[model samples]
Every structure is written in C-alpha cells, then in structure tokens.
Target chain A: MTTIFGVPITALYGQLVVGLVNGCFYAMLSLGLSIIFGMLDIVNFAHGAFYMLGAVLTWFAFTQFGISYWWALLLVPLVLAAAGAIIERSLLRRLYRLDPIYGLLFTFGLALVLEGLLRYKYGVSGLPYSIPDNLQGVFNLGFMFLPKYRAWVVIAALLVSLTTWLIIEKTSLGAYLRAATENPALVGAFGINVPAMTTITYAVGVALAGLAGVLAAPATQISPLMGSNLIIVVFAVVVIGGMGSILGSIVTGLGLGLIEGLTKVFYPQASSTMVFFIMAIVLLVRPAGLFGRER
Target chain B: MPNIVKYGGYSLLLLAGILAPLVIYPVFLMKALCFALFACAFNLLLGYTGLLSFGHAAFFGTAGYIAGYLIKQSSFGPGLGILSGTLAAGALGLVVGNLVIRRQGIYFSMITLALAQLIYFLYLQASFTGGEDGLQAIPRGRLFWFINLENDLTLYYVVLAIFLGGTLLVYRTIHSPFGQVLKAIRENEARAISLGYDVNRYKLMAFVLSATLSGLAGATKALVFTFVTLTDAHWHTSGDVVLMSLLGGMGSVSGPIVGAFSIVTLENELSDKVGSFVTVIIGAIFMVCVLVFRSGIVGEVSTLYRRVVGQREQ
Candidate 1:
C-alpha cells in the first residue's frame, strides 16, 4: 500500500529479496573463484560449468532417481568436489607453470565441453524443479510476501559463506592455505603436501559453486546456460570486490546485488548493466577493488 | 624471418585467394577470408603485444550492427557504412582500452570480457539491434556507386581484397617501430618502462588498431552474408578468434590466416554432422590446443625445421 519513490513498497521489498538471493549466489561463486585463484593461481573458468553441473545433477537426482531436494543439497557438492579433484589432478596440474591466462583459457575450454555436452543431451529448454513441500509457502513479512524457498536460499548462502570465511580465517588449515597462497615453495619445504592442498582447494571452491547451483535450481530455471550467464555477472562482482579477501567478495557480492535490486525498482532496463556500470567506475577509482589490496 | 620467405608466403596467399573461389564455394571462402582478417587483427594484440583480449567480438559485432544499421536504415553507401563501423569500433576501443590498460594479465582479459558483455546487453536491449532476431536482410549494396556486391563472384574478389588489405596493414604494423615497442612491452613491461617507453600508450594504440581491424572484418562479413546477428557480438565469437590465433601460431604473420581458414572449414564441416555437439568439439579443440599444442601448427613446424637444419649442420 505504501509507496517509495513512486514504486510500491511491496514491489521494492520483493525486488530487494530477489537481489539479495542473487547476491548470495554471487558471493558463494566469487568466494570459490577467489579461493581457487589464491591457491592455484588460476581463474578456474570452468567454475560456471561446475555450477551448471551442480544444478543439472540436482535435476537428474530428482527426476530419475526420486532423490529429493534435501538429498541433492547434500550429495551434489560431494559429487562435484570429486569431479573437481579429478580435473585438478589430471588436467589442471600441468598448467601451473605457464602464464595464469592459460589456466583461464584451459578452463574456458572445459566449460564449453561441459555446457555443450549438457545442451546436446537436454536441448536448450529449461527443466523445471519445484520447491520442496516444506518450503513452498510465502511469509507475510508485514510489508512484502516473501517466498519460503527464497528465504531459505538467502539464509543457507549466508551460513555457507560465513562458515567458509571462518574456516579460512580462524582455522589452522586456513592458515596453511593462506601461507601456501603466499609462498608455495616455503609451504612445501615445511613438508606440507602442497599439491594435495591445491587440489583440495580447487575441489572445495568447486563444491561452493555446486552448492550455489543447488540453491539456485528451485529459484530459477534449470538450464545448461544458467551458469555461463551468471558467471560473467559474478566476474564483475569479483572485479568490483577485488578478490583481495573472503569478506570483500562476500560483502561486494551482496552489496552489488542490492544495488541491482534498487536499479530494478527505478530503471529495470539498466538492471543487467548496473553491476557492470559500477565495475567500470570502480576500476577507474580503485582498480584494486573495494576490499582488495593492490598486489 | 627472411624477406624472401615472407614475400613468397604473401604471394602464395594472394594466388590462392584469387583461384580458390572458383574451386570452392565463394560464400564459404568469403566467410573464411573475413574471419582470417579478424583472427589476424586479434593476433596483433595477443601475439605481438601479449595482451589477451577476450572481448574482440565487441568490436566485431558492434561494427557489424552499426554497418548494417547505417546501410539499411540511413541508406549509406557500403564503403561509408563500413568506414563508419570501423571508426565506431576504434572509438569504442579507445574508451575500453583506457579503462582496462591499468590491469594486467587475467584482470585485463576479464575486464575486456565484462565490458564486451555490457555492450552485448545494450545491443540486446537497443531497438536497432532487433534483440534476439537480430538485424536481418541487410543489403549487399554496391561499392563506389558502381561496383555491385550483389553478385557472389564480384563480392568474393572484393572480400579478398579487403582481407588482404587488412592483413597487409597488420603485417606493416607488426614490423614497424611501434610494433617493436609492443614486443618490448610484451616481453618485459618493467624493462620497457625503464627504457622510457610509455607502455600504456603503446598498449592503448595496439588495442585500438586491433579493434578497428576486427571491425573491418565484421563489417565486411555483414555485407557478404547480407545479415548481421547478435551471434557476431557473442563471447563465443571472441573465443573463436582466440582459438584461431592460438591454433595458427600467435606471433607469426601466416599463423592467423592459416588458423582462421582451418577453423572455419572445420566448423563448416562439423556443424552439419555434429549438430548440437559442435560446441563440445570446439571446446575439446581448445583444451587440446592449450594442453598439447601451445606452440601451434606453424610454431611447431618452424621449430622442427630449425631442429632438422641444426642436426644436418652438426
């Protein structure tokens, strides 16, 4: 009933929720990308493909095997983590010594392979995945009616992001990861299995994408293209955030998502380009990103 | 590296361009030539300057759309339409290059890609782009008010001339003093800076030139096909040009031409047979190229030739 700048309060809140949910996904994906970049020194361009695989696997688990969304949320990440580990050990390891750009190129090819295979199998159509029965209804939050599934996505993403941040910042393993990222040779000299750590780091990063994919499956259309499309936006988020710190990516991602939501309220046409517009401005003002230290 | 080998290679390419249209499908050859020029343009930045732009398609596709709009709506002559398109792309290059030159390596690639996607989104939303359906039924239109491009044969020679002209420009640029400075920056940026060369200025120059030439190819392709679509601007087109440059041999003059022709022919053959799996195959080729053939076809051949000659001398 209330109006904010000519747009209904309900509409504004609704778009904000949508933006927040989208931001959560961006946070998770960029967090994974940043972590992988820190450890492996590669951008892991296949991250989007892995995310798509997460969603696709969720769809497959549900329709073919009668696996519920609950089970998928548990299993998809594990499966993708395994796949990530294998890809790192076999394909990515050879690329560490080359220019970091080659890593981006190689993973891009990997993404194409994944997206192409799925497209060939499923066609370009978006296969529907319904929200579970428990999370189907909406919560009347006084001002706006919020879908239960979307609320769950936001909460779950925050939990995952916070847990990841804690693990890297507070835990001893996180210390090793930070150390390895800084100087792998010194870490290796300390008798740590640096290569294995790199592999695990990639796997964990990929698992984060998988988790994001699963979170996104019910909220959006499940399609082969879902990841590639989203990943570019996340890249803008990463650029804006500067991949400097875990908190930076998480904060930037959510913040950009909110900005995008506000844009939708005033100028829906620019919603898509809003993040990019911000990215250009950020690059001009602080090329190191909002939270990133200049390397 | 010898002048005789270089001149002989150009002569051979010219002869083939003249004779091949008669033997193969002219339209297909025209497509390959356009792409060859595009790849050559891309190679100028990647090979000589060590800048990997993942958004060259922004220039290519934007130019195509602009050329199509001007020729179709404004009724501009084809030559003027293309020139306008090329200049527009150069201007875009100037703006984008200025923003991205501060970043290096993967950051550079990512920024270029993101900016290109921004352009892509704008085109998708713009009324002139025709959104998903793309700009269609563009006229082939005559050049110089007399030379008709409606005929496929007449157009093939014209396309060949344009391709050669673009390639020649790239060749000249690569061998010029400016190009040497680009190579210096590529090899060692810090060293180049120490040597008193303004590295960013040289990079910006290369980016604009690369973008303009890529625009030339895309604008010509619109006329040859008489249609301009969003596919021209898609990131996939950017990746395709990268693949062509990588597969051909990035630094060599003949590499991109060879790479473009090979990829175009391969895509043409595979699209009909594999249908939906063409992307997978292209991706597979990309992975293989990066993993096993980083030196590329030309680079490998040259290395092998040098090795054999050294062995004989020994």
Candidate 2:
C-alpha cells in the first residue's frame, strides 16, 4: 500500500532485487575483464561470447548427457578455461607485441564467429533453462518476496568475486601478477615463467566469465545473441569503474546495476541508457575513471 | 604508387563506375558504393588518425534515420534530407568526440562503442525510429527541384556522385597538413603535444570529419535502399566498417574501397547459399586479415611491388 515517487513500495523493492541480480553478473564479468586487461594488456572483446559459450555448453551437456545444473556450475568453467587457454596460446599470443587495439579487433572477430556458429546451429529462438528444484521457491523478505535462485546467484557471484579479488590482491601468485602488470620484463627476469603466467591469467579471467554464464543460465533464456548486448553494457561498466583496480570494477558494476534498477522504477525509458549516460558523466569529470590512476 | 599509375587507376575506376550500372545491378552497386564511402569515412579515423572508433555507426545510422524521416515525413527533397543528415551527424560527432577523446587508444574504442550502444538504444526506444519495424518505405524523392530519382538508374548516378565526393573529401583530408598532424599524433601523441600542436583539437576535428562523411554515406544508403532500419545503427555495422577498413588496408586511400567491395560481394554471394554462415565467414576473414594480412590488400601489394622494383634496380 505504501508508495514512493508515486510507485508502489513492493514494485520498487522488486526492481531493486532484479537490479542486484543483474549487478552480480556485471560484477563477475567486469572483474574478469579487469583482471585480463591488467595482466595481458589486451581487452578481451569476446568475454561475452565466452560467457555465452559457458551457458550454451552447459545447456548442451544437460540435454545430451543428462548432466545436472550443479555439475554444469563446476564443469562449464573448466571447459571454457581450456578453450580460453587454447585461444590465448594460439591466436592472442601472436598479437601481444602489436598495439593493444589489435587484441580488441581479434576478439571482436572471435565473438562474431562463436555467436554465428551457435546461431547457425540453434537458430535465434530462445532455449529454455529451468532453475534447479531446490532453488525454485521464493523467500519472504518482509516487504517483498525474493526468488531463492536469485539470492543464491547473488551470494555465489559475490563469493566468486571475493575469491578472485583475494587471489589477485593477497596471494603470492597475485603478487607476481601485480608485478608483471607493472613491468613484465622485470618480472620475467626474476625467473617467473611470464608467458605461462600470461596464458593462465587469461584462462582464469575467461573462467570467471564462464562462471557468471552458468549462474545466469537458469535466470534467463539461453540464446546466441544474449552476450552481445550485455557485453557492451559491461564495457560501459568497465569504463565507469576504470580497469585499474579490481575492487573498483566490482563496486562500479554493482553500483551501476542498482542505478539502472532505480531508473527503471522511476523512468523505464532511461533504464537502458542510464549506464552509458553515467559513463559520459564519469568520463567528463574523471577521464581516468573513478578508481583508475592516471598514467 | 607512382602518380602515373595512381591517376591511371583512378581514371579506369571512374570509367568502370560510369559503365558498370549497365552491366551490373544498379541497386547492388549503389549499396556497395554507400558502404565503400562509409568504410572510407571510418578509415579516416582509424587509418589516418590512428584512432579506432567502434561507434562510427552512430553517425551512419542516425543520419540514415534522419534522412529517411525528413524525405518521407516532412517532404524534404533528397538533397536537403541528406544534407541535414550529414550536418546533424557532424553535431553528434562534436558532442561524442568531445567526451570520448578524453581517452586514448583502446579506451577510446571502448568509450565510442559504449556511446554508440547508447545511441542504438535511443533509436530502438524512440517512436520516431518506429521501434522494431524501423522507418520503412522512405521515398527517394527528387534531388533539387527536378531530377526524378524514381528511376533506379537516375538514383544510381546520384549515389555514385555522393560516394565519389565523400571519398575525394576523405582523400583531401588525408593529404592535407592537418592529416599529417593526425598521423604524427597517431605515431606519438606526446611528441605531437610537445611540438605545440593542440592534439586533442586535431583528434576532435578528424573524428567530426569522419562522422560527417559516414553520415553522408548513411543518408545516401537510406535513399538507395528506400528504408532505414536498426541494422544500420547496430554495433555489427560498426564492426563491418572496421573490417572493411582493415581488410582493404588501414591508412591507405584506396584500401577501404577495395575492402568494402570485396566484403559486399562476398556477402551478396554467400547470403543466399549459407544464410547465417555469412557471419562466420566474415569473422573468419577478419581473423585471417588481422593475423597475417595486417597490411591489407593495398598495403601488401604496394610493399611487394616496391620490393620487386628495388631488387630489379639493384
């Protein structure tokens, strides 16, 4: 019965919850992108494609092999991580010495190829993905009902993001990564296998996207076209957050997701463009991004 | 290439353009010309200026929509409609260029891309764009006061003229002293800055110029196709431009034209037989071009020609 800004409180809460769920996916994807950019100095334009691959491959396993969603949640990332390793080792490794923009162009092609192959086989119609039985119910949150699956997604995504953050910021491997990001030549001189490190870092970064895709499968219809648009919004999220800091990307992704939710509540028209509009404002005020240090 | 070879090639191409409509489908040629001009506009930024914009379609598509709307709804003639579209695109370029030029290199590409998506969303949601159905049945009305464009042949010439004009403009811009500054900035931004050139201003100018020409191409395409759709503004079209420029040869004057024609022909040939596989083919071509053919058709041929000549002289 209560109203805020002439909208029902329940509707507002529902949108916020939806936004938070979306934010989780953004956090995971952007975190991966930030990590990849930091270590490899290459923007993985195909991050979205890899994420879609995770979901598609998961769905493929489910339909063909009777593999459960629980298994997919663990298996999909590994499969894609291996795929990422191959891609990095074969295609991306050659372009490291060239301008970084070549990396973007190369991945953009990879995305087109991946999305096109899937579209050719499956057609453009949405493929159904059901939530696991245990995660089907809704939880009473006093003011509004929250879907159990969504809550789980939020928790799992947050946990994964935290683990990634800790790994990059706290561990000895993280130390090596940070060092390599700063000066690859110096780190290579220290007897660390930098090329191997580069390959593994790319694989892990892609695995994060795969994990997010698996989490997203039950919530949304699986489609070849799903990742293309979502990736652009994530790009905007990366720009606003600035790829310099790991936590910065996470917080920005979540924060932008919430803002998007609020916009949908207040004015649905601006919801799609709110993130980009905010990006323009952020670019104007701080060209280096909120968390990015000026080079 | 030597001046004799260059001028001879241009003359031959002009002759082909003048005579080809008789042999080939005017509609298809017009489409290719429009895309060729669009790629040339894209090349101005990416090739000459060393700024890769993933959002050039914002200008191309927006101009198409505007030109389509004006000629269809407002009864504006094609000339005025296209002119208005080009100017409007220039205005948009100024605004977007101002914001995106803040970042250099890869970030520039990302920001342009994100802003373009914003524009795409705007077109998708706006009523004027007709949402999903797109602005359809756009008449290719009379040019100035007379010239009937209802005939395919008449319209083909107009589109060709526009394509040539746009391309010449790009060529002139590239050879100008201003273009040299752009190349310098591309090679070394800090050095260009230290030399007392206002680097941002130069970049902004090139961006706006590229956006304006892209709009000109889009506007012509709208007239040629007799409709404007969301596909024109989509990021895929932006990617297509990048591919065209890259495949033909980035930073080369004739490269985008060759690239555009080849891609257009390939798509035309394959779209019927393979359906969605066209995307895969294009993507594969992109990968091949990036990996091994970085210099592109023109760049590689020129290099080879020079190498053989040098050997002969030695």
Candidate 3:
C-alpha cells in the first residue's frame, strides 16, 4: 500500500507485471529472430506474420471445430513447424547464397501474402479468445493482483525461451548448430546433414514464433495485423540485444519490455517511440548493438 | 549505335507519358508519376548506390505532411511548399543517414525501418499532422503564385515537369563522380575505404539525395490528391517502393518508371476485383522477383535485346 516515487507500489508493480508479460512475448520472438539470424544470416521479417497465423489458427480451430486451449497449445506449433519447414525447404533454401537482405525482402513478401490472405478471409477484426477455465481467475500477491493466465504466459514463455537457449548452448545438436553457424561448409564436411539442419533450424525458429503467438492470443487481440505490429518492436529489441548473442536477446527483450512498461506508467505518450529511440542511441554508440559482436 | 536506341526508347516512353494524359485519366497519370518519382528516388539508393533503405515511407509521408501543413496554414505557393517539405525530409535524411551509414546490408535496412517507424509514431501523436485523419484537402495553390493548379491539365504539366526533373537529377547524380564512389562503396566497402574514400559520407550524401527526391514525390502526391494520410508513412509504402524498384530493375534508368507504372496501373485496375488479396499478389510478385527475377522487367528486356543484337551481329 506504500507509494513509491509518487505512484503507488501496487500500481507500479502492476505495470511491471504487464510489462514483463509483454516482455515474455518480446523475449520469445527475439530469441527466434536471433537464432535464425545467427545461423542463416537472414533476418526473418515474416516471423511476425507467422506469429499472427498461430493466433488466428488457434481461434479458427476453436470456433470451427471446438478445440480448446490445451489442444491449441499442443497442435498449433506442430502445424506451424511443418509450414515453416515447407517454406524453408521450398523457398528460403534458394535464397541462402543471395545477399542476406533478399531473405528479409522475400520473407517480407511471404508475410504480406499470408496476412493478406487472412485479411481477405477474415477482415481486420480481432476474434475473441476466452481464457481457459483453469487460468480464468486472478492470483493475489498481497500488494498487486496478477491474472493467472498472464502469469502462466510469463512462466511458459520464460521456460520456452530458456529451453531453446539451453538446447542451442548445451546439447550436442546445439554444438553442431553452433559449429554450422560458425562454418556451415566445415560442418557439412563433418557429415552432419547441414542442409537438413538449416531447414530444421528455420522450422524451430518459426515454431518458437508460433508458440509465442499461442501464448499471446488469449492476452492480446487475435488479429491478422498483430504480428506485423509487434515484429517491428521485436526487430528493435533484436538490434538492441545484438544479433550475436541468444541470451542477450532474451535479456534485452525482457528489460526493454519493462522499460516500455515503465515509460507507459511515467509518460504514456512515449511508450511506442521509446524502443526505437533507444535503438538509435545504441546504433549511435555501439553500431554492432549492445550485445552484438562486430561481423 | 546502341546508345541512340536506348535514348530513343527512353524518349519514346516519356513522350507517351506526356501525351497519354490527353487520352487516359490525368489524375491516374499524375499518381503514376508521383509513385514513379518515389520509386526512382528509392531506386537511386538500392540500384545505383547498393543500399537498401527500408524506411523510405518516412521521407515520403513526412514530406507529404509538411507540404500539406504549409500550403494549408499559409499562402505558400506549391513550389515553395514542396521545396520546404523536400528540404525537411533531406534534413531528416541527414540525421537518419548519419546514424545508419555505419551499418551495412541488413543492419542498415533494419535501422532505417526502425527509425522510420519512430517517425511514424511521432507523426501519429503530433497535433499538426491531424493524427489519423491526416491533413486533408490541402491547397495545391499556384505555381509561382499565379499559375492556377486548379486546372487538371496545368497540374498534370506541373507534375510531369517535376517527375522529369527528378528523373534527370537522379540520372545526373548516377553518372557523377559522387555516384561512382557510392557504387564503389556498395560493390566493396572495405576496398573503397582502403582506396581513401570516406565511405560513410558518400553514403550519407546518397541517402540524403534519395530522401529529398522521395520527399519531392510525396509532396507532389499530396498536392495532386489534396490529401495526406497515414498510409504514406506506413512501412507498407516503404515495401511498395522497394517492390517497384525490385520489379523494375534496380540500377537501370527506366526500370523504376516501368515498375511503378505497372504496379500503379495494376492496383488501379484490379483493386476492386481482387479486394484485399491485392497485397498478397504484390507480395507474391516481390518473392518471385527476389527469388528468381532479380533483374526485373526492364532488366530482362535489355539483356534480351543485347543477346539478340549480339547474335545478329555474329
């Protein structure tokens, strides 16, 4: 009940919780982005659109077939992972030798296509996604009351983010990925099926995006345009974190989300522009980004 | 000579553009020219300079707002309003370009896009821009304070002149020593730096020129439509310009023009029929161009012409 710096502690903490909730999304999305950029040397511009698809498809599965949230959680990522693999093997693989910017452009086109098709079918409205019965209530944390679903989202996203990081950092497959990232041809010479790995890596990155989408659907609007809107901010987060470090992406994403939340509490008007402004300052001072190593 | 044929081809297209207003809709032609200028300015960066600026809509839309505000607020003539808008965008370019010139390739692109989004958010909040409604019904005014822009023909001629001037300016810049250095930096940045050229400065110059020209196009479009909307500032517009240059051919003189006209014409003719899928169609074209047809329509035609001519000579 105490006031901290003119704002009530509960109010401040509530905003921080909201910020961290959004940051969970930012962390997950940017982690996928860093993985894709690190290994493929291509910035996946379509990441957001795919994220949107996960949300939209979740809504579709439920409304059309009465599928529940648990089912969506289990089913959506697999479907998206398959779609990601197809997109990679069929199209993205061809762009590997071109300038990395083309991958950004080509994926941009793909995002447009997917979003456009969805928009054409569904219009621009946000379909309702009711929270599951188990996560429908609030948790009393004494000073600040947290919604159970929101807290679940945070925990799930953090777990997923850390697990992906661990898989890349600790596992043998992760070692191969690290090796291939450093030298794809050398890894290929070791008979590790580098091409298949590239496709799978891309699929994994997008599957992470899909998972984030599912986590986000109940909290935010499950709309076609949601992905494009969030993707820009995620891009800034990736830049701020630097594309070199996976852990950097997670930390920066979460921290920036909190900063953005703090900005919302202090100066509501600057919340949108704050991340981009930070990006400019970072580029000005550390052109490679705060966590990024020079290429 | 082949030079005469190429010049002849260009002249023929310009003449068609000038004469077509007599038969086709003047408004649509004006729209095409505005987009053509925008695409050409965009092409100047990507095609000739080898820098992909993914945030050009910031320049285009910001200029539109500036020109709209000036002409609507005061008695500023069309020329001065557009000039001021373009200068403002160029100044913005200097700031943005200075920040981004240090980064190369995709980093440069993401920085530009992020910075443009910041500008978009700024405009969205600022009072003078009229927010979501944008600055509507902006006065086109007179050229030189007396020549009436009310007449559609007069406005068409004015628009044509600006488009031609912009194209010529880009052409001259491309052929200049400055442009050569910009291309050198694009082709190989480390080598250009080793060869004693200040690469970042050259890049900044190119970026400013591109921004100014794009601003000019945006200001003109504002006058032609008498309205400036948030659509201009959106990232999608930036993507559209990239698509134009990509589909038209990057470095070639007429590629963006051909590319812009193709897209504008397609949108004009097909939007009603295709509905929202129009974006998907455009995106598909972008993917095809990037994946397979990196050289674009004009690029392919010229290459084919060369092969045919070479075979005939043999």
Candidate 4:
C-alpha cells in the first residue's frame, strides 16, 4: 500500500470515509437548524434531543415490533415529525412573539426533558443496532477497505440533504417557504396559510434530524447522550457555513469533515477540534461567515 | 424610612457573609464565594451587556489550570500565578470576544461555545493540562509573606477578601457611567450607536472585564481546591454559570451571588439524593426561569417589595 503524507493510504482513506460519514450527519442536522432558524428565527436547541429520540425510537421499533432497518428508515421520520409538530403547537408556538432567546431557552428545557426521559428508560449505556443483512460486509477498494453500511449512510444523507435543498430552493413549495421566511404577514395575506407552513417546515427539519439519527444508529452507539455531544459541533458547522445559505451548509459540512479526517490521519490530537479551528479562522476573515449576508 | 431599611438590610446581608465562615465549614463557604464571583463576572456580560456567552468556562477553567500549573511547576508565588492566569484569560477573552461580538443573539452564544470547546480541545492535548487527570494536587501557598493558605481559617479569610473585592468591583462597574452605556447598548444597540456611543468597544471591554474577573475566581478556586481539572473548562461549566445568573437576577448586583449559592447548594444536596437527574432538574429550572421569571429571583423580589411599599403608602 502507498503512503500519502507519510500515512498509509488505507489509513488516510479510512479516516476520510469516517469524516464523510460524520459530515453527512452534520449536513443533515445543520440543514434542519438553518431551515428552522430561517423561518422561525428560533435556534432549535432541542434538535439534538429530537435526533436522539429518533435513534431510541428506532431501537424501540425494532425490539417491540421486530421492525427491520428498512422499515425504520421510513417510519422513524414520520414518528419524529409527528412529535415535532405536537411540540411546535403546544410549547414552541407560544414563544414566537418573544425574543429569540425564549425559543432557545424553551427548546433547551425540552432537550433536557427528552434526554432525561430516555436516560431514565435506558441507562447511559448505549444499545446496539445491527447492520442490515444486505449491508453487513466490507468492500475492498484497491487502497482501502470500505464498510458498506458507512458508504450507505453517506449516500443516503447526501440524497436527503440534496432533496431538502431542492424542495426548499427550486420547487414552488420552496418559493412559498422563502416568501414566508422573508415576510410571514404578506405570505399569510396571500392565503399561503403561513402558520401551517411554519409548522410543517419545523416538522420537516426535525424529521431530517430523525433520519440522520437512524442512519447514525448502526454506525455509532445508539445512546441518549449522543446528541448533546454532537450538537455543539454541528452549531460550529452552522456558524462557519453561515445559516443564510443552504448549499453553503452542505458544502461546508462535507469540507469540514474531510479536513477533520485529514487531521485524524496526520495529527490525531487536533482531530476533535479541526472543525472549530477552521471556524475560528473563518470568523476572523469573514465575520458574517462565508455565505452569510450582512444583515 | 423603608429605603433606609432596605439599605440596612443589604449591609446586614454582607456582614453575615463575612461572619458566616466563622461558624460553618469554611471550605464550603469559600467554594460558594468563588462560584459567586464567577457568576457575577458572567452576569457582567449577560446581565449588563446583553451578550449571553456560553463559553465562560474557558476563562474560569483555563485560569485555574494556569494558576495551578504556575504554583506547582514554577517559582512564582500564588499572587503572581493568579495574576498571570487572569491576564491569560483576559487575553483569550479579547481574542474570542472580538470574533463573537460580531454576531448577535443566538449566534453569539453558539460562537462562544464553539470557541470555548476549541480551547478545551487545546487544553486536552496540551502537555501541561495533564489531559483527563488534569493538573492536580497544587500547592495553596501563602498569600503574601505571612498568611499560610494551608490553614482553613486563613484560606477562608483570603477567599472572603477576594469575593468582597470582586463584588465591590462589580458594584462599582454597575453604577459607573460606562455601565449605563452598556445597558443602553443592550436595550437598543442601534439607538446607542445613533447616540454616538461605540457600542462594540463597550461590549468588548465588558467582555474582557468579565473574562478577567472569571479567571480571578477560577485562579482562587484552584488555590482553594489545590487542583484544576478539565471539568471547569467544559461547555457544561459555561451552561452552569448561565443558570447561576439567570436564577439570581441578571441585572441586580447581588442576584448572581444569591443565584450561585442557591444553585451550588441545590446541586450538592440534590446530587447526593438523586445522582443522575441533576442536569434534568437544572434544565427544567432554566426553562421555567426563562418563561416565567425572566427578571430572575432578585429582580422579582425587588419588584414585589417596591409594589408592597407603594401599597402601604397608598
């Protein structure tokens, strides 16, 4: 095997794959955060909780009903979306008129409640979800061995993020969302049912997090504490990518993942913080973020 | 008559704090006082400047590490070590605050958290921090040439002086014209800018001041505990300080100290009773405080007192 930058090709490729997989989660989660922030002006701090909820729920579905991974891929989002909708209507809706800080505080509370409930039910230890029979094996690419499940996760997350971007940016529904985000009153005046649209938008965003969680279940440990750790990193991704641009978030997520992977290969010590280190640099050069427009 | 009584009541409270450690466990009281100072420093940003920095643990924890390292590894005494730690934290705050203050509201919070996490990672990797074990078993050392901090009584008085000094500094800042400018900026930045005040400068100053003071508290804490760990610098520590300020009363001078004491006491008691659910409880409190008591405990009490006095006069 050849060496790149004094590291084995396999080692480099493996870290890159890991980075891509992590990036996919970042993109999906950050996409959700950006979309919700765009329309609601509320930073949904409970998003990680929702993602954790997805993983836990998937585990439950499998254990209780013998539901397979294929079924979970479809079912988890619907369940999480329904939960998200209910939460929006019941608690989140009330804080729309207040400072955006209130939304953050409320969602933070929601996160604690959700995580606490999960921890209560299933202790801090993680539960394992088996790789599906079809994607259980590894494929050897000349230089590296690739896990089929991880590749699938990256492809699936890419598809989800691209589809979300298309629906919000290219389609008529996307047009309506853009209008609603920009001028809710005007959109409502035009008979767009802005409130319902807002509710749906939030649900869809959260459902994205759920879908990511499902994908992550097999790759990482399915634990209640997983989301809290990941969300802060995702927030940095959002900051670096700029919440204003959809494509920016996707590209930044993937790019940052690659950078992190490279760091792991060359300097394992900095791998954990490679994304944030880049974020600091980005902030210094472009205070509004690379894609964020000056407000 | 009532105004004089209120003033007298505050003085009595201060007197009690000075005298309490004589009777109670000085170590616990010292811990509380250090945390109180930390909370007040945090309040300077969130309460006065309206910037909710979620990464103050960087200052608090990093300073503790620096102070600990200096006393244990170097020739410097405790005072010099603490000053160096505070300056280090202040320098870090300046760099971070410059970057974060560009964004407003939730974005600011995220930026601070991310930057703090970066510092955490740096510390984790740095040789001096000792990673997971952290820098432990630091010498408390004497304050000057005479006072041995190894004695609980001597340490308690030292901590008391620091806390009192910190509290008075915060008080002076709150009453200063500079503080009024910060309040103005917090209430309405555009208006303050229109009024010819350089809002960003005021904010950065406040941020640096808060970071320095938080570092001072952390440095003192390291001396008191004779150890410094990664837990102090973690994002959760930042969140804990936020909870302290919010619980105490954001804008009130004594509110953060009260908030810090209550929260520390509550956590100690509750964690003893129900080990794992403390976070859930704290989170619940955060939600409740944000929704129902935005002005916080001190703010609410003061308002109620004023109202009751008005009723009596009527």
For all candidates in order, the CA lDDT equals 0.93, 0.93, 0.91, 0.89
* Model 3 residue A59 distance off true place after TM-score fit, in angstroms: 1.1
After best superposition, candidate 2 residue B191: deviation in angstroms? Answer: 0.3
Colliding residue pairs in candidate 3: none
Q: How would you encode candidate 4's per-residue C-alpha lDDT over A1-295 as one tens digit per residue? A: 5887788888888999999999998999999999999999999989999889888888899999999989999999998999889988877787889878778767877787788777877888989888999999999886578999999999999999999999998999999999999999999999889889989989999999999999988889999999988888999999999999999999988888888888988989889998888888888898888888865
Tens digits of per-residue lDDT for model 1 on B186-217?
A: 99999999999999999999999999999999
Question: What are the TM-scores, per candidate, against the unseen true structure?
Answer: 0.99, 0.99, 0.98, 0.96
Best by DockQ: 1
Q: What is the TM-score of chain A, computed separately for every candidate? A: 0.99, 0.98, 0.98, 0.98
- iRMS (Å) per candidate: 0.6, 0.7, 0.9, 1.5
Model 3: interface root-mean-square deviation in Å:
0.9
Chain A, candidate 4, TM-score of 0.98
Stretches of candidate 3 off by over 4 Å are none
Candidate 1: Cα lDDT at B89: 91
TM-score of chain B of each: 0.97, 0.98, 0.97, 0.97
DockQ of each: 0.89, 0.87, 0.86, 0.68
True contacts kept of each: 0.84, 0.80, 0.87, 0.64
Instruction: Write model 2 residue lDDT over A1-295, tens digit each, in one string.
Output: 9999799999998889889989998999999999899888889999999889888988899999999999999999999999999999998999999999889999999999999999999998888889999999999988789999999999999999999899888999999999999999999999999999999999999999998899989998899998887899999999888899999999998999889999999999999999999999999999999898765
CAPRI tier for the interface of model 2: high
